[model samples]
Target chain A: MRTEAGPPVTVVVGAGLVGASIGHALTGAGWRVHLVDAVPSHAMVAAGLGAGTAEPAEPSEVGLVVVAVPPRTIADVVGESLQTYPYATVTDVGSVKAGVLDALWERPVDLTRYVGSHPMAGSHHSGPVTADGDLFVDRTWVVTPHRKSAEASTARVVELVRACRARLVTLDVDDHDAAVARVSHLPHLVSVLMAGHLTDVPEEDLVLAGQGLRDVTRIAGGDPGLWQQIVRANATAVLRELRQVAVSLDRLITAVETAPTDEAPADLSLSRELERGVDGTRRIPGKHGSAAVPYEQVVVAIPDEPGALARLFGDVEAAGVNVEDIAIEHDASRQVGYLTLSVQPERAEGLAVVMRDGGWTVV
Target chain B: MRTEAGPPVTVVVGAGLVGASIGHALTGAGWRVHLVDAVPSHAMVAAGLGAGTAEPAEPSEVGLVVVAVPPRTIADVVGESLQTYPYATVTDVGSVKAGVLDALWERPVDLTRYVGSHPMAGSHHSGPVTADGDLFVDRTWVVTPHRKSAEASTARVVELVRACRARLVTLDVDDHDAAVARVSHLPHLVSVLMAGHLTDVPEEDLVLAGQGLRDVTRIAGGDPGLWQQIVRANATAVLRELRQVAVSLDRLITAVETAPTDEAPADLSLSRELERGVDGTRRIPGKHGSAAVPYEQVVVAIPDEPGALARLFGDVEAAGVNVEDIAIEHDASRQVGYLTLSVQPERAEGLAVVMRDGGWTVV
Candidate 1:
């Protein structure tokens, strides 16, 4: 630990994934971190599991307090924290920024010691057990500083992101919400709706589902409580994006309805439309944080059964290749399926050779 | 392998995933199967890849021809095959039945030997590579027998499905398209549109994506050619479902845009409207084709590195527990993260033990 200054005292509220994570990262950065959760024993539950521990918080002793509770409860928590810890600078890591801003509007606090921040990052998993110290590395952390926010406070938050090795994105509260609504919130809702379809399916039929269904409906399994709060909090912007999606869907429906008969020479138009939709959608990066450079895929063939996937990944790791994305295709009839791994373009050739040498089939 | 009597020969045309799977299954069922594909190499590829293959075709030598090809091309391929091999009973595995029916509208053929079929099973993958003998096992195989269709032909097709271990779903051409449009086509289009949004994202942000983004956008990587054909062939039904989804989306937008502020609690009416949409959508089945069963989750803490997930899964598997779903929550600020796995009600306790015994932190 850096002794130049007895570690910077950092405080995190909530023992959820976000809060625990912030605490872990700060501790790794030589910061003396204290965690606080609304539930009295929450911090202890987390700390005993090796995630980290929260020290009994005192208002004046902590230099910074981060509120990482659910969106619906963020404002109340932030406000209480600000009032309770008068000397500490306050910040929040909420999904929606404008909601927090609006909630804090009436509660006049020392604005100079507060800044609004959101990291455009998360896993589908949640809570303290999943918190990691390096989760923010190379991720985007948005800093929404109000005009009333003190420059020192803003810098402190920026420094917090830097300490975690995360990139900084600055935007106003509304813009941040809108952008997230487009990138994250809308996607969540769409996935939920899609997965909800499976809710009524006959149990036997779902067994036939392939990787596509698995991938498309993955987010549907998210924490309903957390999602309820997120969607409700960012309802306006999320719905706006939903409407945009609705427009495209409507157009697609219209085209499908009026499509020519299969015998007609020009009947390929609908196919073209569907193709357009697909082409438009592949712009998403699979695993790499950098969307600009798409990861290169190398498909590996493996047999179906236990330990097959585990061993394949083990080989990838053994070869010192980082797999950015992985897709598995398995059908028992063939007894063999292919696994597509997206690796850095520069590493693909080397990774393929190493994997093949490890007694795996690379396609 | 059953030597009591040789099963009737089955010839499957087109040799795609569905067609090949049917052939593979039939061959496995003691049937002398003959598979054909226009692209002369298709049979070889399909068989070599373990999807299916043909034992040299003699004119009218097989009992049935299962045409499994793209919707736009199915009609032409089936028509030609029907003419070329007049004695073979024939059926097709196309998504859009209406288009194929319309294509054969006035064609004079042995209707007694032909029954239209659509197996409501597929993968995001395409072609012979993804074909498997078990693809149709326990899945629904819709058989649309025409008015003039021979009872014997329908029986043969039904027998074909039975051999594949798939359940029978009887429906006419139009109804099948409409139902599938609702369940499959519309959802796929939605996935594409959402994934397409990230195409323009800068390279920097792409690398930061986690399992959530991957899950939501996975289907976006599907082959455009196959999807285009599907959307075009089943345009009418797809369009209908898209309209229904649009209505739901519109209502959601209205509710959110008009949401009450702090002065008034969010309008319960709007929330109800959104809930209705959610309820209607959730009627879809969950995993294993079962009815949508709402589950409560327990997240487990796990380390952030290689073999963590593997060890976790190995323990869960060793406990003889089936996992409904698995999700990983990664926090950028923390180096640790949690993995949330969905399991059946009866298996949750057992799974917790498996994790605990495996030295994992299950919360």
Candidate 2:
């Protein structure tokens, strides 16, 4: 059995968000990392952008190889690497596992040293410009190991994921596609559809679109090329889920058209619909595989200044409060900002009371 | 012209999230607030739940009455209110306007004393229990008036909204409905459709749902009764937008099915699709009717403890930087938490540098 000792040698392919992040994480953990990309200039980009690297060499020299290329290119990149160097246990960080696995099936490579992976972590921003070393520090990293995948190889990949401070989740290729379709892919489609509708709005009317719309449709602004590949790869499941959404929307249309009156239903009221929304939403995973955490709010008044919020936070800290999440709204005309602090449930009321006593206009 | 003093006597009907919040806001601003509802027991429940009082005599002497009842009942309530009580300027806060305006059209009362308003602020959390005195602060409160509405009556309602510290936008009834359909109703439909898809998930699989899914579908958990009223009231525009969304989703589905392999069209890649998504998303209005603010993230490491996060905030403040938004993630098993601070563009790098130098791990 190989002993877990000093930093392992990790090689990450593709100098983008996923790849660089892996390298950055491994390097931060004291690992000897060699990042590779098809573009020779990628080594410099990756190193300078902070994921770390060197020239690619024999795979046998490294403990693991993480393929972080595009979905369309993942198979080719993994296959090529395996063809040239055969000793390292290889894994991939592709969004769609089945497609990559299917493409790699016919390749003349060692089957034992290969595993399929997808770290369910991303940002609204993309490419190296948005690269950060801690991108996967506390996110879920999914590993899809087929029946033929060697146990040792799977364990090694899981170790690498854990070393990067990510929670490990095991699944089959098909299940991964289906699960991600429901959670990630379907949301993107919904966002895109809503965003497409906005295009039809008259410019003047469109100007009134607010935070609610922006928050709901935020994911619409994703990389189209990348999303096309993901949707195409996972089309069957995405389409199946999209059909379900269509049916739900159709029922809503019918119900709205036939409502007893314009007033909300007395019993099933809008609250019930919203409750269902909340229930389903809670089923989502939270920080590092924990259950989803709902937001709790605390309203604080802030003066208009460069560091007003920093001062408010400092004041909240002085009052012995821990803020879990925060949202800020500024009224430029009034020259003030409303800071909404989302804390743990038990702490919310206490913090609010404390902030109130602290005299920062705790709203 | 009349000289205005401090707060006016205000009456709120229904005592729900909207009504109670209005009452609380008005009362906080030094107004004599009279809250009324159909059920006497509801008043106790409302006040106990944080909504406010429901005294009948309060409306008898008030200068303005805000009917916060459901859309369907607004017409009957407003019609009766206008004929029954002739002393005060009258207003109603309903999602839809055309119906309410139609109900009031033939009333043998002073139309000059009536104005219609809808505050574009709400919570998935309903009723008096979640009533916040500052709920409308910094949010848009749309004031819709008929062509014959008296300027003084309109000003009265506008003053109330202003006192609540909300931004005011004046529009005709039809314009309000159309605007809300694009910004509010359509988003609700999309959220509901997406959340309803959760019904199809295998129970075991859904237990693994994560924050991304919850974020996109959170609004789906809205009050079905309120949504029903809202959708029915704005049926035409909601249906039109839904059809538009359906068409766009269908196109996306088609693209997924027929897009070429590695030879994908220039704009068909997922990355490209996501880029378009971002572009369209940026079009939504943000604070001050400006472009939506995108965050610059600063990830910091915190120890797991009650006062750890508070202390971090203290240090963040000492760094002399303002945090625009914040998200925290705690890895229980690891005994550490990752706190992400969203700061203005120029401050992120400087703050990160300072936090790191201050002996804290800033990623």
Candidate 3:
């Protein structure tokens, strides 16, 4: 049996994007990471990228086991991990938790040592080639502990979240699934439905597309096979959320159909639904899970040339105000780019003046 | 009567975001602009910002008139403009083109001098304060010429689009409405519906929200009053798109309901729908009305201190490769920012090396 007094060591099963990223981070933190995968090449590739060692020179000293396989294979792989490392805390990084736990009940594995984890850092791109130690930085990592999950096992998983520099949120196994269905799975399917319709749109008419369409459809470009597995594992919750959206969509259709011709007042119901959306969107937390703050943007028209940004940044630094955030907008057709600096509202006026004095066009 | 021999002159009505922006651009181009608004203060404020002169010293010899009022009031304002400025080409920058033409048929205004122009630079922020001369730069500006519209008036509208540095796409008036429904209006309602569900979600569960949910719902935060007017103008086409999505959604619900446990392989139709989304997302044009080109991102961890970006951009500029685009990501929770620079595929490796050698963390 492993003890907390021993050197930290972990066995990471399945060297995919999530697994490899965890391996990379644990290795960097001086943990002995044993990277294993069904595909030997994937394990080798991940190890070559300095994620961990593929060779298991010793096994009895393993302190924790992390299962990072696909959703459908998570139950089997996690079961194997618990049996292989009997004394180690076991956890599976599956997007869906209840499905894995329910499947595990039929197997002869120790439920007390197993917990469920889902790192809310999803990317369309997959594989070990895209893995990074910083992927989970400031991200919310949910740890789901069922009724049988031991407090010791949950605490060990919390250690992993801290090591990854992620914020921790403990939830029930089933509650975790429901939250993801409302936030992630449902949004993914809606994005897919929107993009799928684009398949029938004429290429020329698509010239009218804007940033809104681009953003709304971006997630639809994710891997279909992987998403299929994810949604299947959490089918019930996803269906509930999807049906709710469908009801609202039907109401929108009716509103659009009944609206009188232009120049006449319409029913207030459509406006109310739209206002609800406005409120909901405002409820989302700001980037990095920070509370949302009101920011005013100071727009700068930057010339596309060598050291233009350098000059701009130097001038901004001279103003002694930190730019809270920035968005750089460029189009191939234009030589000038619009770089919007989001700063505290109180500082916007002074920053604009400072920028304008620097001979930079502050739009 | 105005002639081509006279100096460039135009009367801008509405003095809102679109109108003020047009006035701003035209004034910068050395044209004499007379800005007017239903609310006298709007024109006064817009003129104060150098959009144009609110006081019209002379009314004769006006070469063109741009009507940029609310969508519901466009036809009335535009008809009045044509009657007020005889022999001048008249155009309205409305989101829905066919509605305006449809409403105009009931009036006695000459159709020869009128054309429909929709500057596809819609922003959630409105009014003159949010207006800029560069708002229309490289944006798609659609000009809709009806069957009876004279070629000279269409040419004048085309020139206005060019003066604002926007790309021109001329289509039939009714076709313009259909295209916006599919590309703009429908996506908007989908975004709204998706966000509307967030109202019922527990605030704690919303912490699970990622960039995908935020992106998909960002447009939902737009002013409900403005969107109500827009969707109403293009109701028929918006209704058609929404019904089509509804049909696809019903199929999705059935697939979700019948799916078996996680370990089993399910139907292929769900996967096909997701794959179609992947294909459709790939079909959207790249930024700046350009064809989509494959670019690789060189991720740089920028410190949240002054002169950090200056040094980074300095190193990047020294590499002698221009960054095709840049996305600046900063979270208030972290002291470090991830600045992803999108460059041509061939230049990424060299740029990364340059950044790393300069002591910047290239992730």
Candidate 4:
């Protein structure tokens, strides 16, 4: 392996949201980036958005080539990128790593030059228009390199992750697939299945939806074509999780069906399932990848004006409290919105007092 | 039926979040309000928070008695309230209207004075301390009065809904149950089941969760005890939906299992299911009860400082654009946040320009 001087030159193929975002991040990090896409306009659009120049990389000149394509095409694209740029270490940012690696294994491609990676970051919106340079910041980027993969190739991908400011998690192909199936793919399908029931619901009934329904179905709004491919590519792992979920659903159904009509006794099985849900939720990592810490939420009523939130944050800062997270609750017809601020438990009381003293209603 | 005069006196039983909120709203609307709870301290706290006076209503003096109890006890509370306040109309705000009404039918209580109502409003936080006077403003209040309910009783409940500034949707008991089963109960279970899967997830994998998982599992964090009662009360309807979902999952699992290894063709059933999900998501009512309208989202980068949101909103107001909705996205370790502003499609470009010109990053 030869060491290159100055900023690394990286090429990003497939100019969709992830690809364009990678290009944008790499360009911002002083890496010379070249972008390509099957649809030439997508590459041009991504380039125009300052992601990179819409030019193919010269042979042996590129240090790394990142293939960000649909799951079905990942292996093909990664193989082509590897063969096309002999000197560059190749990586693909596809959701399903095992299938792609297996597909490549079946081919005559050089496995030593390639690594499979997936950045666990995305937006509801797609396309280059929604591509953001800082999209990968603080996100986990999982790299799955097989036994045949060269150490130099894996190091090159790690360099790419560093340039994008994403945390790195090294997992084998099967583990990456299983982890994503449990965390991402399974949840996506669950959201889709839940939202699917809404198709025939009356408009009047749907008008009664609250934040809970919104949260449950929000990801169901993703492009169907993209999700179909993802689900198909990770079919084995996703099927395993789906089967587990189906069994759980059946158990819950039976628990509900056999529940006493007239409150004979507490439904132990039903309560146990709900308790398990609480346990599951508690397992989700809080900010900074720490164990999920229950934060004290302080609800403040803000006038529906432009500067109200800004002013509230100002007051929160003045009170020496850090706002960990916030959610805004507003109705179209209401002139006031409630801003729920999640903060450290110890800081909540003081912040509430400060806000209340500053003439804000804190509940 | 006797008509009452001069700002109708209302009594709210069960001083939890919903009941206290109703009390607060009614008191603010010029009603003589009284609050009661099985737990005396809960009523006292709600009263001290200015929701209402912690006193029982005099016989024949209360114009309306609102029973906001657990679903299992709703019928009993509503029946007792109706008997105690002989001249007053009574309503219960249990989630499952049909179950409560059926429980009432099994009793000797008069049905003419009682109405089954549910306000489709809530927050993740529970209890009286989290109550707010405007909680029901712009929310749908479903009144599921049976055939035996008197016109006067239904009208009185409508008046209460009006006083709270909530939109009213009148449905028969069975229809209300079915509608909620499709929209609310089923989604809640899906969220719970999805969250339940996370119980055994490794912390390293849990850190990979994104917004999709967050949204899907958010409501799973609700009080399990409360949810257990709710699920049990609506078991019949919820079970029906659960069975349908289980079938869908089974079908999806089969489709994935039988999928072509070499991507010969897309799994027709899998694609169709996902397409149905897209259709379903589009059917959800948007702001102001309109059909879901796709809004153009403009991303604005805000400095991680106090008043950043306020300044952004101020600039947005200065641009004379009404933000349809806004979401704040920030990483725990990041010093900047992305505020995704949803606006009228035509207004998005102009707002982006205005934001960019105002020294904000618009993507």
Candidate 5:
């Protein structure tokens, strides 16, 4: 991503969200990024957005080549990039890894220059137009280097992650696939299945929907064609996780079907499933790889007017609390709304006191 | 809940989050609220939070009695409230309406005054301490009036919902349960199943977790005991939804299990499922019960210093864009982070220009 002379020279193949994001970040850092794509307009569009310039004549100058393409085509693209860009370290932004490695097993390519990496950062929104240079900042980026990968090449991939301002997590290629299957791919399909239930539901019935259903279904809006490739690419690991989920579903179904209207069974499998979910959430690492810190919200009634949020948040800043997040409970028809400021658990009371004394209603 | 001469008088029983929230909302509307609970200390805490005063002896003066007890106890408490408070319209905020109505069928109490309501607003944060009067503002509150419910009683319940500033959706008791089964109960279980998959996963593997996983599993952390009661109370409808989800899960599992690593089948059931998911998300009503508006995010990189957010958002407001929501991406060790401002899709470009012109880095 960066070089000793001016900036790193690299070739970004496939001008999509991930690729254009990389190109944008690298160009902003003064890198000479050569953007290329099978669809010529895609590369041109990314270049027009200042992600990078058109493919340069001197391909051998690129110190690194990032293959950002569809999962089904990643191996072929990576293979071609390695063959075409001699002396360059080759990496990719593919979500899944083992399939690419399996596809590359018999290919007559130099494996020493190849290191596989997956930036855990992504959005349901796709295409170059949705790209942002800061998308990967502070996000966990998993780098997987196979046994045949040279140490120098892996280091280069590591630098790519660091240059993007992303946190790096290293694992073997197969381990990366399995971990992503459970953490990313499995949860994705879970979202998809839940959303599938919604397609046939009556629209009038949807008024009952709240934040919970919205949260559970939000990621189901990702491009279906791309997801089809991802699911198929990581089929083995994904299938393993999916089967386990199937087991839980059957158990929960039985629990609900036989549940008595008068009283819950003494041995409540339903409660057990809900409890297990709590434990599962606990397993997710918090920011900076720490235990998840639970933040509490201090709801304040903010008048529906301009500059209201600024004045309120200014007071929150004056209270000397680092607001972790904020949510505005809004409706088109409401004149008064609530703004929930998420702060450290221990600081909520002090912040609430300051706001209340400052002529604010702390709900 | 309000009367002509003074604020309307009402009794809110069960001082949990929902109950205390009702007490808080009603009290803020200038109504005299009486809070009671099986655990008297809970009622006292809610009273301490200014939700209401402790229950008074003269309950007959109240126009409405809100039974906010647990689902299993809702029938008994509601029946008792009707018997105790003559001339008061009795309603309960049990999530499942059918079970409560079924339980009240053989009671000697006057069924004429009883109505079932479910306020869709909630948080994983529990207890009276987490209650806010604005919690129900703009939230959909369903009023389920059975055949036995009198118009006067239903009107009083609707007034309670209005007093809380909640949007009202009236349905038959059975229809209410069925709708909630699809929209609320089913999604809850899907989240539970997804989160349950994480429970046994290695902590190291969880480093790959992202916002999508956090969102999908969030409601899974709700009180297991309460969820157990809710699932049992709405068993029949929930069982039907669960059976269908199980069917979808089976189909999805089959698709993934047989997905060839080399090439996908001509008839891609996987893609079909993903497409179905996209269609389902379209069904979710957006703000003010309209079609979900696709908000676009304009990410800006901001220095990690106090007052940066206040100033940045101040400009956003000045730029004539209403921020639908905001998210800050942070890690323990970053000096700079990204703040994504969500705006109407059409206004994104204009906001970005205004931001950049104002010396902000619109990434």
Candidate 6:
């Protein structure tokens, strides 16, 4: 990490969630931050929220200029920021980097001072009101340095990531787009397609929906205008994955249609695809980039009253067992909830016994 | 609703999750449930768990016979059960009703004695070990009686659902298959297709997975064999939905690829699909078959120590605000978690004020 005598002065362009959040984190870190936005009220709102001071950029004194504009306007804004703040290293926080870099390449702009970065953190809500100072903490922030980028510029971007307390991952622009296409863009569209089916469904049928349907379609509730831009920005990569899904879906349809008869031998193709699904799920990293570990879950019945959860947690804490994770499931009709606690496999039985003995219902 | 002086004795076949859960609920409701399975060990395990007694069915005295076998064997098993217990009403709790009914249509069995029912309740786990008596509570149980079925058989099935505290929805066999095909089968395949794309993904890319991908692909982690059976059993209905999805995916690809240029007008199709997704998600019942009410979420930063969550909940309770729901998000690297409490919209500000005044960080 680069050590400085005082907090670095940084200039933030755009007062959206990403930009505001970056300002909030840097301000809380003792940085002198200036926020500028085309929409004056947005900048004022972000400033009021303690993100930064709503003011023009101090071009000469600024050490870093961060552009957190939408994908379509990123290149133009980055070009202007670089020209205005000639002494400062400039970077952008756009979802797609390769397209922006290509757009910049078309302009007569200096590329050596620019590094493209994307903090892989977001919420369903948009704008600065949903901004949190700790949004990027412990989240991966991808830094994509073009071939023309200077070593010093790359170093400055890394320092900025460190100041925001985010894990740094280095990738080329193309590689970054492809990775997000698989992990983010593809899943997003899949959610949309699944949820779109519900558009014409009868209300009576939808009443039977369960947790499985809910989980699959939760992300479909995001803003369409923003997502359209994202999908369009990375169209090539996303289209590639979408075609792969189409082919897989076709094969599954065939497999289901030609499933084995009672007297015939079983077909391995269907099982093969499902096993592949299992394999893919296993590859997702759990907390802290670790393999997904299996935890024994102990479900405790708790009333819907406010103090019930507190009492249950107190009882669990008294047992000296650590709770790894928790999920609260409510039975709407009964107004009762099941608090599922995940703990070390060996400790589950002990924890359940303790909770049950303490007058709690453990299932 | 039908009323009886005492809880009716019900015999459950196939001691799996659904079967054993039914047994557990019925037994808890004062029913004498006999548990049987081709696999003797499964029945014995269900018996040990107090789901029911491991014994042969007393056909002459049985009031109801529930066939909870896999979809492929449901018809055959239901036929044998109806023949064995001539006086008892027979029902099979299979995921797909039409396929089972069609199979029975080809047999010489008495269709008037059978009722095809499906309880839309399941978990990722299978078998009796993961069974819970409360699984069916607040869940929808569909009863699709055949055209040749008598009213008495349907009434018995309705009483069974009432004993398990499940909501009842009656639909024709074809309608039930189509409804589940749209809601359950389509989502499952979509999850499978998305997850299959991850089969060959680089581990580095998979590490960037977030809650969005986790939620979208969660159902993909289920048993492949069981899912294959489910998809195949409802092939016609599932294939129809799958084909519709294929057309939708194609349109989405075209929309993304041909997105509006800077000088061109914005495309309406992409935005339309996304808007439809939003509308669909809005229609899902929030709790207790009520409209999806939006709750205000307040996030609190808590230490990872033993009593930190308990203390936070206690503080919230002391403020006298009811927590509608809670989601605990842990930043594993930092060992800190954000406990997000959802409350009534009108009470959020007051709750935040109280908690902040009590030395808690509320965001």
TM-score of chain B of each: 0.84, 0.84, 0.89, 0.90, 0.87, 0.91
The candidates, ranked best first by lDDT, are 3, 6, 5, 4, 2, 1
Per-residue lDDT of model 2, residues B1-363, tens digit only: 113566566667787778888878887777877667887675566666544455565434567888988887888888777765666778988878877787677878788888999886664333213566877877778899898789888999999899889888888888888888987788877877777677667654553454446556857766666677777778777777777776666666666666565665554444444555666776665556665587678877786555666567677878888776565654323335667787888888888888888877765
Ten contiguous residues with the weakest lDDT in model 4 chain B: B121-130
Docking class of 5: medium
lDDT at B44 for candidate 2?
64
- For A67-115, candidate 1 gives per-residue lDDT tens digits of 8888888888888888888767789998888888777787777767889
User: Model 4 chain A: which ten-residue window has the lowest total lDDT?
Assistant: A121-130
lDDT of 3 by residue, B165-262 (tens): 88888898778898999988888888999999999899888877776888799788887888988988888888888999999999888877776546
lDDT of each: 0.67, 0.71, 0.83, 0.81, 0.82, 0.83
- Evaluated on CA atoms against the true complex, candidate 4 attains a DockQ of 0.59
| Order of the predicted models by DockQ, top scorer first | 3, 6, 4, 5, 2, 1
lDDT by residue (tens digit), candidate 6, B1-363:
223456556789999889999999999998999998999999999999999999886678787899999887998999998888867889999989988888888787888989999987665433213677877776778999878999989999999999999888899999999988887888888888888889867878887787788888878888888888888789899988888888888887787777676776687877887888888888777766677888888877777677787778888878888888887765324445677788998998898889889887665
Cα lDDT for residue A145, candidate 3: 87
lDDT of 1 at B81: 73
Candidate 3 residue-wise lDDT, A1-363, digit = tens = 566673358989989889999998888878889899999888999999999999973556787889999887999888888888868888988899998999989788899999999987635433213678877777678899888989988988998998988878889887899999998899999999999999999888788787678878978988898899999899988988998888988887887777664665666778888898888898787765677777887888888776788778888888988787776766435557778787888999999999989998776
TM-score of 3: 0.93
The model with the greater TM-score, 1 or 6, is: 6
In terms of TM-score, which candidate is stronger, 2 or 5? 5
What is the fnat score of candidate 5?
A: 0.69
Q: TM-score for all predictions? A: 0.80, 0.86, 0.93, 0.92, 0.90, 0.93
Quote the true-contact fraction of every model: 0.27, 0.42, 0.75, 0.68, 0.69, 0.64
lDDT of 5 by residue, B257-350 (tens): 6645446454478878899998998888776566678788888878766677788878887887877666665543344666777778898999
Error of 3 at A326 (Å): 2.2
Candidate 1 positional error at B239, Å: 1.9
| Candidate 5 backbone collisions, by pair | B2-B8, B3-B8
